[model samples]
Target: MTAAKLPAIGCEHPMAGIARRTHARVPPYAFYEGRKQDWRFSMADEVTLVGQEAEGLAARACRGAGATEPTTRSLVAATMSAALFGPPTLGFPHLVDYLDSFRDGRISTNPQPKLNRPFAAFFVSDADRGIAQLGFDQAFDQFVETVRHFGVAIFTQTNSYTAGELGYFVRRLAAEGIVGLAATNANAMVVAKPGGPAVYSTNPLAFGFPMGDGSPPMIIDQASSATAFVNIVAAASEGRSIPAGWAVDADGNDTEDPNLALKGALLAFGGRKGANVALMVEMMSAGLSGGPWSLDTPDFRSGDVSPGVGMTVIAMMPGVDQAARIARARTQADRLAGLGVFIPGVTGTSKKEQLTIPAGVHRRIAEFAANAPAAGNMSLA
Candidate 1:
């Protein structure tokens, strides 16, 4: 699970009840990892670079205040995701908000919603979060419980959206029993096995599933890289080697040394198999979406300039046949496993279905989610 503190995430204030249609490009800076020395003072400088309004910053500070006892160290890493992934995603689920809740889920968008032209009327869904993928019975309960906890209900879907379009979907997708999952693809963040610098980050993916029993699987997220790059960078910052297989060094050689690994490229999952998957992710993320992708380009933070990395997401519906497919797959697969073979994606579903969020993350969820606004309103200031 992402163990970092969420960043103080805020957006350009929406003018009127609606915003002037502005198709924005990716921001050119990495996420703001709040600094150690005079951080707010430092941010005053970066905010100018970001060009977000003072009102927005005020909003963020207000949102950050609720943590009865908020900590800078805790919030720094968490907030970093917000700064990095926010713009390209059009503020779907703020990275800080999602990371604050999920260690595994992701963010994504539908290109059709982003198109712009002269004298054209565009309609963003009245709903923003795509939690619709979780269906009604489940999403409603989650919303009720979450609002009871966080004071706000961030939307979800099998697709991407903004705050403006989040609510309607919550009601609509719930009626049909469709599971909603709202997630985003942040900067191409990949952690390879300390050596080979082949492609982009393993990237992060988030999902939400609804169930009649308990909360069901409302959220599932993962990094597409070898290991989460945060861990890799953390190891590097500590001058430690990443657990072998998570990174590599210059010249494509596997090295456990985190510093070298940080300097090198991370390997894709499943070796060639994982590379194929990462490639597909890259295509969907950068290729199909027209967002920045990890090309032969270098990390912009460094002089090494290659293509920047990004993400792409596709949402699917289990529909009325979801159960049938699961049952049939399970029966058929059981028969096969009895004979020595097994299923591929089924394992993923099994783990996803597990109740308690799998790691130390649940406590964090209970803590933050509990105090979040009933509408999930921002509270810090």
Candidate 2:
């Protein structure tokens, strides 16, 4: 189908508006700043692209893969944020999943997300089987305003694809000087007990607090599972065995085989403790948002149907003594660092403007863009 003939998605001109609305609130990209070193690819197998070039290529690729204009913009922004600041696996690698979903009818190419404010400080959105980022993007302005006015606000979304990186939601709030916590769930792949059936997704959670000293926010983002599902997939692809605690075989016995793990369930990090955390995240995300439970959600990898997961983000405004409190926190953080405590989100400022992506991933994305129908007047901003 021609780009012009595609059904209306959300906003037709989302890039210009998103760029303006988010320019001051989103943290600057720093080329994988604070990202874990283990996720990096070998330099020999990587290709470098300027930030703008990466954005342009990703946007075109999304459109070429049958995503609508608004969906393309939202996907591009979130994917870029992940690629530049969050984990490498959730960055360009994850976008490939969405592109395939769009082509396979697992993600609606022209979703029209709908928003509702059921209460003064409670907002909900239905993503209409589209990417999760579009729903959050649509409600961001109002959500921030609500948080500022009420001191706290809760934003929940349902009927969207699985969230890419939970930290991306809270990080935006931290940039605005607000403390934030976010949680999201996906299809069932994690077992609460070592020998039990899968009862939760990875069920990740993130928290962010602005440092108030012009540095990055103190952010903590992690999955409740021992390892992310992607790691298992990667191991299986490389013909490697996984760690014993990572997952269990189909018979519910712990195993070190990645191939067997794929047929079984992932284990929680700290046994029952991690399972409890996963339960809390499940309630906060899927239960509160009225989305399907992990047990009921479809698998994201092999589905022709949408997983339709949910996300919950809570934004809290600092009190009237916000400046003093923030300063004190920064001072305490400095003292802790001096005492040899490793801070998760503290990193030196990086002036790098280019990203090193896996060459194979880059070529695949470029191929999508090259094969796509012409997108007339689509803004790369």
Candidate 3:
């Protein structure tokens, strides 16, 4: 039960050294009576500050690419500030390449194998445009199809692009009667607190479940940060200020100034617990998937290199009485609704329409749209 008795493995990251020998803390005696139980013990705090990469910037990479598309006018408006100011020079080429990947589902790694195992690994190399565009969706659909044949599938993807809207993938799968859960790590942009070093990305996580109705599935997606970095950038672009505790200044002091916060770091949603979740995500996305740790990935804002990140997707098949299970879940949801407990994402899923953007943000987006090169034809130089 001590650290010295645990197994250890040599790794490039400092935390990995600690991780190798830490699994023995939960002694073998912890198993249940007459049966062996599964247990996963992780080192969640060691590497938190080592090189937490910029997940906010990674989110911006997808937001920027989506904004450039003709079909994403509203998205463009919402993210105009980031496109115009955040990494206008270095982030553009990466965005363009990600968009190009959408035209063809050709990624470095393909998921064409059997889904019989409970876990599978999928790697989308930086080559062939990575996980941008609809490539991930295409790959995920294939995963769902294969998993449905089996009972459950847990797939991890490394070396992928910045995955935007992690819930979108799960929602569609839920509609197909497959429950889906997903999480992706980003570059470092958040801290444990104002005085603490920024050690983790506001890693986004999502889950979707089928309701057995023709309506949209029940989906919930959220970032671990106090607020998504994109919103702060948008607010800064409009010369607005953020609320206290959302971000810190360069000296690690609390600040409402968006610009100052950008120079500093974002605050985790709930102190150590949020940081713990971020680390959990980092392990699943990068640690387990053979992807670059957040600290090792290139900075998405000014670095010309691709954001080498990872995503984890899990698909679960229901039992033979699937309809009955779904009906029971709906009944619970109905009871909660009757008690005035609102379900997240229920209303937004049923409605699809454009959201209004600030005049300044909209104007900036218009200018960028008019002057930008074709997504596939962009150049880093």
- Per-model TM against the reference: 0.40, 0.85, 0.60
Who is ahead in TM-score, 1 or 2?
2
Which runs in model 1 stand beyond 4 Å of their true positions? Answer: 1-176, 179-198, 236-240, 296-311, 321-381
TM-score of 3: 0.60
Candidate 3 per-residue lDDT over residues 199-227, each given as its tens digit: 66667777887778855566776667776
How many clashing pairs per prediction, in order?
93, 0, 7
| lDDT of all predictions | 0.34, 0.76, 0.50
The per-prediction CA RMSD against the true structure, in angstroms, equals 15.2, 9.4, 17.9
Off by over 4 Å in 2: 1-44, 230-243, 257-259, 347-351, 373-376
Tens-digit lDDT track of model 1 for 292-346: 5554333322222212233222233444465564345346655765777633222
Can you give the lDDT of residue 129 in candidate 1?
A: 25
Best-to-worst TM-score order: 2, 3, 1
Best by TM-score: 2
